[model samples]
Target: MHVVVIGSGIAGATCAESLAVAWRNQPEHRITLLSASPMLKTVANFHQLSRTLETFEIVERWLDDALQYPNLSIVHATVASVDTRAKSVLDTAGRRHAYDKLCVCAGARPNLIATAHPEHVIGIRDTESVKDLQARLGSARRVVVVGNGGIALELVHEVQFCDVVWAVRDEHIGTSFFDAGAATFFMSDVKLESAGMSENESTATLRHGLPEEPEETENGVAIFTPHTLQQRAAKAALASARAGVSDIPSSQAPPEPNQTAPAMEVYSGAALGPRWQDQARLHPIGERIDTPRRVVELSTSVSAVLSPAEFVAYRQQHPAIVHNDTDILDWPAIVVLSNNRVYGCDVVVSATGVVPCADFIGPEILRASDGGIAVNDQMQTNLPDVFAAGDVCTVQWPTSSHWFQLRLWTQARQMGAYAARCIQAAAKHELALLDFCFEAFAHVTRFFGFKVVLLGLYNAQGLAVGDYEVLLRVTRGHEYIKLVLANGCVQGAVLIGETDLEETFENLILNQLDVSAFKDMLLDPDVDVEDYFD
Candidate 1:
């Protein structure tokens, strides 16, 4: 049996590792890991925080360490398309790789607001894109961050020494993760948040610092770096030649009139995972300022992205706002928000959301409304012998009451491992039950320098307004806890800071115990909530 995994991201890597370990004794079976970039993301030092929540550090390893499996082989190539009828994948290099089973973990791409202006409008998705943003920020005096997602939230907090114009469509920040109350609670800390990286981030920087250029040793070990210009040009030339079009001189060339672009035209490196911002420096170039350096513009979105020349003409017909109106001309670009306000800035970072990278996937495969390939409970796609996991795939099964799908690393890792098990079971003609991890939704992340743990319908997702009761325990600048209760049972919770209530809360959600007797005591800091039921 042969399995071809199309991506070396967290999902693909985890699935590959699981299969390799399960089939280590079976030498006949072969596994192939395909990646566009040479560097493969691997999960390390994994810790299961709860039944549904797991935490791990993402470690980027080169080919040297990736070749540990004897039965598995890693191929660094960009896939052009997958021919389900032929049971093969065609790479940009015009090579066909045949496989008995296929897993499309191709991951996702950033949904940039301004697709036309790539130079001034940036979307941070991977190591390459983040590096590009860092370069532009080096000389930037002001930057506009647009989005209400995690990337936008983190960028607004991490960036220092330069003014940031944070534009959000929602009235409050972090609409994706937090409710209005939670957002307001975090807002208190946002003003005083430190510019320094977290301790884990500092260690990751020291341990796996990326180099400016690839440094290959005599033994073949090399420090990983972004694709060089020469390599990129060669790929572009190959693609252009395949399309029968002349090579364009400009780096950002448009496709030949009426000519279809090559398959590799939309290709990108692997999607970045946890701690990506740690290594990708976001500090803007300027002297440190004692006061906060951010302007929050709520309930607005970017209506248009304009160059300086366009902005000069635009200001005559519209209005532009800046602290120093005289220096507005110095900005490289101008952003016009939906609220009729305009601001001039050097760069605009769009962290809006992501669209699944399913362009290479054929139309025969069924896709969800969100554009990701839809998969069943077994992680099997609509086509037999084809599977998909991670951000590239959406779970189409009937989910548990408290569990839901989100494009998060925790869910990605879980889906990958479970997909491997399903594949193994299918090969053996056995049944694979839904994994317990899907019983409830749990995620652990950080925001505003505080530990955040979300479990089981956090933020009252999908619940009707005023249908559920909420309880809160807050300590200004320290901790914030919110619990969702319905019908005398704990339905969901948002625990922030070092509250140490995750274990008990997780059990409460899973067990669905009637806590109505002590519901009020759940938020009592003095009382041991865990001991009440014990």
Candidate 2:
């Protein structure tokens, strides 16, 4: 039996490796790995410089060990399409490779914003782009970043040369992974502000001439009038740009240098259009909206009022109106925009998100549904004999009601292993379908500064909501502990600014233990739960 695996990312590599192990003693199965680029390279290379560099070396070692398996083969080619009916893949060179089973692990590509100029935008997806960004930043005194995710935050911290402005459409940064309070704290430290602004509060507002009213039912969050937040964000960006030009203190200043110079500013705004609240929950850190003076609570309804339709349409109707014109486009000598053209800048880096590149899997083999490939629990595509994992396949997380695809590397690796097992099982006599139910859990543990960790599913319902216990402590700083429990069983937890019992907490989550006996210990910080395991 021959199994074909596409892609060379974490998921693909893990799946192939797992299958090779499964067939190690059998020696009857043959594995073929194909990729568009060299194997083991970082996926988009947007990670830390050290991590990106190490990925290449790690992948090379992985491949070397895998090649030792006599039945495995590796091919370097771009897959053109897959014909599920024929059980074959066609490469760019028109060479067709047949397989008994195929796993489509083709990952995603960077999603670029339409407003960005392609020539000025550089995506940090490869080594070349990183080099280009470093070179561009060497001379840049001002830089504008358009996204507000982890990558954007990391970039802002790493690139110290110039004035940095982050243009975000969301009310807050890290909305998905953090709670509102946490988001506010992060923004406070980072010094971010929301874009857009409003006029007199008494006046009736109209976004694209549609009468606007506060949305009260959802979250009761404060709403920024249309254009108000964006305007404020734009102004902040302009201030940073202006500061970049004038704030450089002369070399001959006081012996004790003046420490009151204004710092580089970052402006954030939510994209206009229908707001995706659910998407916000998926972020590893929760989200927040930033104002010039302070972080603010934004009403969910505010998004409905400031929909992207009106914003984009308004810009379309009034071409002369632009945000942060003085800083971004229309500044006199420092910056200039002529007919929507920018003259300055060595390079523009695009830190936009990514989208699955599943087009290579022919339409017949894997039909697109709702912008993602529909897949069964076994990770099999709609067509027979073709399986998919990673960003390409849309698999529902067992815990969350959301049916979106799991794009994280962790999920991809697990799905790949499961898919390989299913394929191998299918090759033999009829076997019982494995239980598709797998808990969707995510957690993070921060060490050194504050030991912070989050586990299990916080977004889902019907599991354990109020039944869980929580402990809040205020000592030197603050410590928060939350646990999820169902029928006295410890499901998951979140611990912040504390690590005395982290190992015990992690084991409880991993083992899915019934903590009924130790229910009283949940509140006691001194209790050593690790002893219970022993």
273-334 in candidate 2: lDDT tens per residue? Answer: 11112122211121222221221112110111112334445446547533443333222111
Model 1 clash count equals 0
Error of 1 at 489 (Å): 0.6
Q: Give candidate 1 misplaced runs (Cα > 4 Å).
A: 192-267, 284-292, 319-324
Instruction: Return the clash pairs for model 1, or none.
Output: none
C-alpha local distance difference test of each model: 0.74, 0.47
The true-versus-predicted C-alpha distance at residue 10 of model 1, in Å, is 0.6
121-227: candidate 1 lDDT, tens digit per residue:
88777777888888888777778987777777778878876778887665446766866557767765565221123444322222221222443221222211123
Give model 1's TM-score versus the native structure: 0.84
